[model samples]
Target: MRKLFRRQGEQRKIRDKSDLIVKSNGQRNSELEKGINFYAEYLKHLDACSSGASQLSPSDEAHTQNSDLYDGKATFATTQSELLQKLEDAYQRESNLEEKLKEKIKSYQELKEENVSLNKQIESFTTGQTKLAEKHSRDKRALVEEIVELQRRLDGLTPSLALKEAQIARLETEKDTANNQVRNVTNQLQCLQMKLDEARRDEAVISKLDLERRDEMDSLRNSLKRFEIEIEDYKEKERTFAEDLSDLKRALREAELLGKKEKAIAEKALEENSGLIKENSELCAKISLLEIEIAQLNKDNEFRKMNDINLAELAEIRESEKRSKLEVSRLQEKLKAEQERLHNTEAQFDEYRKKEEEVGQWHHRTQKELEGLQTLSSSLSNENKLLRQDKLTLSDRCEELQNKLRKKDEEFERMRDEYETVSEHYRKVLEKLELETALQHERAGEYEDLVNRVHQLSASLSRDDSSSKSSRGKRQTASSENSSGKSTGEEKVQFIVLNLADLPVR
Candidate 1:
């Protein structure tokens, strides 16, 4: 009996020790698990914070389902202190993450600026066409000066060429005069043979001298007049070249300006988009906090309040008015610039018109040349006409080619617009398809979850139904036995025990 008591005491002591160890082990395990869960929740919260996603707060992280343990126990105090230290570490990590986000924003802005500069370079490349225009302007003035010099030289030379033509005419006249002189000399010599020949010979010499002087004078005057006309025509050609150059330059400048304008606008819009993204992130953060607060306040029955919002905004109105005024001023400046450009264009057009007039002068000069050539030779005039016809054909062909090019450009523009529209529409379709696919996936997951939940509910309902039926059967049996002369209270007590056995413990 003493040995049995001693063994029993030892067993009791072992049991108490084992229970204590097991309880401590279980507490350690629970604490470790809580720490692990908290860490996971912390990580999740950080992720949610980054994306501005709706999530639980730090208090939620520290909270537990076992409020009793928190209220009554100092046992987990060391572990709780460790977790608090971890939370502080997490807060530091969050602060670091915020710094990283700011750096990312700064980096993004820098990249955007770099992209804008690159785009500016691209626009400048597109505007390389303007350089040709500017060259045209310089070339115009140079060509005009060159043409004027050429006209002056032509004028100086024209007199010689005219003089030559006039000399040839004089030669013809001298030939005629020589023949007449020959006839007179022949008559004089014939008559002088019969008489004294000195007076007739002297008269023939005087007539020859007079004829030569008259012929020389006629050649010189004709030469001078022809030279003057040729010089005038050359001057006109110079003016025409200058006009063409100026027109081309103006056109190039306009194209360059347009390219820069469009590029600037695109860059501005991109900046606005970035700003909007930042604002959206801030709004989402605010919204998440509001949602959590609202959820927490939802259970309070005293929160029946309807508040009216007076959205009297001042900054937006002031900013908008400022922008409107700025826009108006910009429009006015643009209009003024446009007017200046218009005047410049008009001046260029006038120069071109002057060039056309110069071309008319060339036409007249060419006509005069043709007339002279026609008078000189029939074959030459026919060849000149052929050359004119060739020039006209070339000009017509150039006009036709230019028209075809313009049409092609317009067609290309239309095709580009259509392609852009198609691409945009395709992009929208892809986005919609992605959204639908996500929705389908979500619906599929929800369906599976619902199916699993239903199976679980069905199983629970079946178990409940079976237990209810069994309890009813036991009660009916107990009642029947009572009717056959059993203790009714005892049977009722037995039925209660059976029902108690069927129920699960909390």
Candidate 2:
């Protein structure tokens, strides 16, 4: 148990050391990141400072030279000369520092390689430990196999003991039966004596009794001897059976204990691997985030370049914005025209409704038809939405193009808008022409109804004319009859129209 705790403590120390290494690595990475940032920043500041210093120092040098030109030449030259020397020394110092930083970066790279090597070592060790555990498990399995064999033999012995007990029980029953027979024999003997006393007057009955008693006693003794032999064999088997059973039980217990230990070890190793996997995932995520940050910074630098645009590009972009807007307006007008046409069709549906009622006796069929129409309408509505979405996409594309070309396309957009407006007006006229189609349909329906009425009236007039010729004197003149027929037909049609209030017309 102390050894187990010692191993656990050693493992814990190793875990702690690994944790510390990971933490130190994180700190080092942070320091490296900071160093990179500082290096870049320092370079920026150095460039700015160097430029500023160079510019200012030259001015200072020129000023001193001019002052020396006014003052004593020798004294001014000496002071200017000392100042140049000091500037050169400071510049040399900065250069040396830059070189040192580069060396530090190189050292950081070496440390990174070392860290990778260490990680590889850890992985190999982990694999080695896993192989050991597998070997241990294989050994335990062999032990279990041996234990199983022992159990099977022990199980076989248990049944043998049972069989022996059953045999012993049968032998005991036979012995009891034999003892009863002996008692019966003794009673018979007493009875036989009583009989002999009585049978002394008759000698034949006594002779028969003696033969029967001898045969029964001899059979009872032989049975008892066989039972004794069986008991001895059973006792010997029970002793060996007890020893084998104890051995099998011990082996079974050992196998169970070994299996538990192997499972526990496997669980522990799994936990360690899982922890390592989690750490790796976290590291990968961190690296990805760092890469993303770098990309964002680069993009920002590029974005700043966009601000340096001169005047000409801005004008072109503005102009493109104008032409795209005009095209979008034309498509909007066209969509409006389509929507208006659908509305007019819906209004005409009211007239269809009156006809539907006249045919309303087929109400269920009408309702089913109406459901179909509703479904069609829903489909049309979906199509309309899709068309609208397509229009939106076109508008977005136009806007993006306009934004990109505003500075260069101003004249082009002005001309395009003029053409678009003309096209829009022509498209509206087409919509008006479609609306006129509804009126044409209504007129056609009215003309058909009028023609049908005239036909019916003419048939009635012919029947009246025939009946009059058969019953009365003479036929009327053709022109007068025609005028009379037309007038009467017109009046009858008007009366029919007045009576039928459920007309399908608007």
Query: Once superposed on the true structure, which residue ranges of model 2 sit more than 4 Å away at CA?
Result: 1-210, 294-506
Candidate 2, residue 11: Cα displacement in angstroms equals 99
TM-score of 1: 0.17
Clashes of each: 0, 8
- Residue-level lDDT tens digits of model 2 in 1-506: 35444545555654565566557555655755565575567557545645555556678856754654455445445645754564465456546545654655565555556556656766787898899999977965565454434434434444553454354346446545654654665565565455445534333433444344445445544554554454455445444554555554565456546545645654554565466456546645654664575466446435644666544654554454455445445545654564564455445444444544544445445456556655655665565566556556655655654454553345445545654664565465456545544654565465446445535544544444444444334334533544454445445544544433333333
Query: Candidate 2 clash total?
Result: 8
Could you give candidate 1's per-residue lDDT for residues 1-506 as a string of tens digits? Answer: 35444545555654565466557555655766789787677557555644442244545544531343444245346646888886676666556655655665566566556556666766786577588788877876565455435434433443463454354346446545654655665565455343333333434554454455446445544554454454455445444544544554464455446545644654564565456556545555655554554454343212322232222323444455466556556655655665565566556556655655665565566556545544444543454466556556655655665565566556556655655665565565556556655654564464455345434433433343344344546567653532332233223324433433342221
lDDT of 2 at 96: 59
Per-candidate RMSD, Å = 74.6, 86.5
Please report how far candidate 2 places residue 199 from its true position, in Å.
9.2
Off by over 4 Å in 1: 1-190, 193-220, 243-262, 277-506
- Each candidate: what lDDT? 0.51, 0.52
